[model samples]
Target: MLKRICIILICFIALLANPLQAKDIIFYGGDKNSYNHQILHHALSYQQHTNYLVKTYTGYAPKQRAYLNLSNQEEIDVVFGGATIEREQLNHAIRIPLLKGLNGWRIPLVNKKNGNIFKNLSSTEEFKQLLAGQFHLWSDVVVLQSNNIRVHKATNVKGMYQMLHKGRFDYFPRSILEVWSDMERHKQLDIMVEQHTLIHYPSAYYFYVNYQDVRLIKDITSGLESAIKDGSFDKLFNQHYGEQINKVKQTLRKTYQLTNPHLPPKTPLSRKELWLDLNMHPTT
Candidate 1:
């Protein structure tokens, strides 16, 4: 009993020394290797004085479950994903485009045998005629539908890939940041990235917190703004996506620029520096 008391006392003293830091800032729906996961910690690092304890959920949390957890503040503190007007109204969003609008640059995943099907795509109308696959809950679905593109909804990434491989959908448009990794992960499914086409729209991925968590909201927003101002945000972004960006710029592709009707009004459209100008892509 005496030894037990002594150990308990020591543990108490250690806890006193650390004071349990801030309420853990939990990220959901992604592992540490994901770009959003890296950026979350990176932005939060700018606010060391807050002493936030950053953690990621141990397994893949479905996007719906993550949002539910975030809404209840039960299991998640933040979620990173494409933004829409409804989402901004429901949560305390950091407003910084975590992907610098690169999430909007989409490349299609085609079955290997049909890889060259998009090579000569000449118009947005022609592109729209090809059926696309998207997770039903994603903002991308709405964007595609609003643009008159036909989309078949899938419940998960694996199923979507399977559907694409089996010809249930003509193509699955994945973000430029995601397609390479996805292609690598699902290589066994006989899918390939469409080589000669790119589809883009205006979109932003943001860190969102429950509306009641004002302190976290302020800290995250300030931290991201500080990171942006200091160039660390771009540095980190380039470190992860520089190769893809460079390749997309150099590639010869027919580009389709779509309009996102549901984009939140507060999106920093005026912040020219925060967005990549795909217009700079070579026409060749």
Candidate 2:
């Protein structure tokens, strides 16, 4: 009898030991606009792993929700695609950094003939001066305003491309992956563009868990760390983003007048600065 009781006790312990509770993680992020969202979708697609249910909001809601930790108050489990600093600051946010499984491709939309406007303005500051009182772009304008670079904000990529084609905005920024992902959407837009800064902004994405679901965060973090250890992170990143990386590098070589098309053997920029360069890929 005692032996049988012991067996039951062990079985019970085993069952309790497995803590993947019925708790579902509410993943909040942008409206599938980011590559991080796609990667999270693939990772959490399994039936057993289905507890990580996603809840998306348009625009900056995910960012807002994360900073606010809305899901935590409602007992939701996790939020995907927040920055490391964000995770660190949020009391409940765990730092399970994920590889965004993405590579950036910086493309410049410039006029067909006048490349001199871009000559002295390789960095953002110089470019801002040249663009003083010029065409507007929300993204570029935001960057400029932060650094005192004034410019106008265009409605959308298509509108901005039209501005560039008509010699309105001097040179605009875009992601090659974004353009390729929506090739059909942007196909007929006759914008002469060159993609540069190949292989910029390789980063580990993260699942920031609320403090309320500390145990759940631990589980997800473990899974992700395992993924990282065995190289699953890079595998996924390289698999999906690899082709785009290659394509961008090739295009940038022919398109933009970059000092170096490929990432150097040793980069001069610090980690933080390098990431900025990778993300911005300003023609230098």
Candidate 3:
């Protein structure tokens, strides 16, 4: 009996020291200060709602097509991108709008000398005459081209910026959440925000997980819903983008509404609280 008791004690100690490990949910993101990093951090916050740990693997792919395709292969556990019907067919989208549809609110970047050029333009037809820079694979490219807007496609971010600097495009539309920081980083390129106009479309940014990883999808969906109900999601969004919203409100820019043909039919537009109404002035 004494020998049996000794063996049990040793086994219990070993179990204590080697407890079960938490499952790792791989996150593929961009470098620091990029929108990808912001999405990765938001995904990491979901960890509080699940036993699985989120681990970021940066620089997995520099282009949207590459990373999104990686998710299809199960090489990447999660990827953040604009929601589209085609994208939904490829991966399991969490379906919660990460930015509350703010990704569709585009502000343009243009040469400082030409900034005043857009101030007087009031129609999409006039805007279409100007060349816009965008990624070749971005859904926005399709939207722009469908609307008869001229586009200059670049495979990478730096190349796009260089193209803009070289006068290849008249304006580069950037999300309200991304334009400011991006401007600061590329100040040497001599671009300025087109203060007189903004673009509006119906779009959402969503976290898409591998279709085979149903467990992770459920965990993230539950976490996001809980965060929304508890107001934590809005708090985090306001903390990061509230100032930008306020600044946009102060500018009396003429907004041109564009149709996002790629938006999925099942988008949660009924959840009013999950979106920002540009018509109503932001109080933040």
Top-scoring candidate (TM-score): 1
Query: Candidate 2: misplaced stretches above 4 Å?
Result: 1-20, 30-72, 82-105, 114-140, 144-150, 155-158, 181-184, 195-205, 251-284
Q: Write the per-residue lDDT of candidate 1 for residues 1-284, one digit (tens) a residue.
A: 99999999999998788774565678874678877888788777777556776788765667767776788888788988778777776677788888889988888999988888887766667778999899988778888999899999988966898888888988999888889899899988978988888888998888989999887888888888888889888998999889999977777777788889978888998999889876543222
Task: Give a tens-digit lDDT track for model 2, residues 137-246.
Answer: 22334434554545556656446656666777556555555646544455465454543323233333456656666556566656555655666656766675677666
TM-score of each: 0.77, 0.60, 0.74
For each candidate in the order shown, give its overall lDDT on alpha carbons: 0.82, 0.49, 0.76
| Candidate 1 residue pairs in clash (backbone atoms < 3 Å) | none
Full-model lDDT, candidate 3: 0.76
Residue-level lDDT tens digits of model 3 in 77-149? 7777778787788788778888788888989988876878787675667877888899997788988888788
Candidate 3: segments with Cα more than 4 A from true spot: 1-21, 30-50, 58-75, 135-137, 154-168, 188-190, 279-284
In terms of lDDT, the poorest run of 10 residues in model 3 is 275-284
| Model 3: how far residue 158 lies from native, Å | 3.6
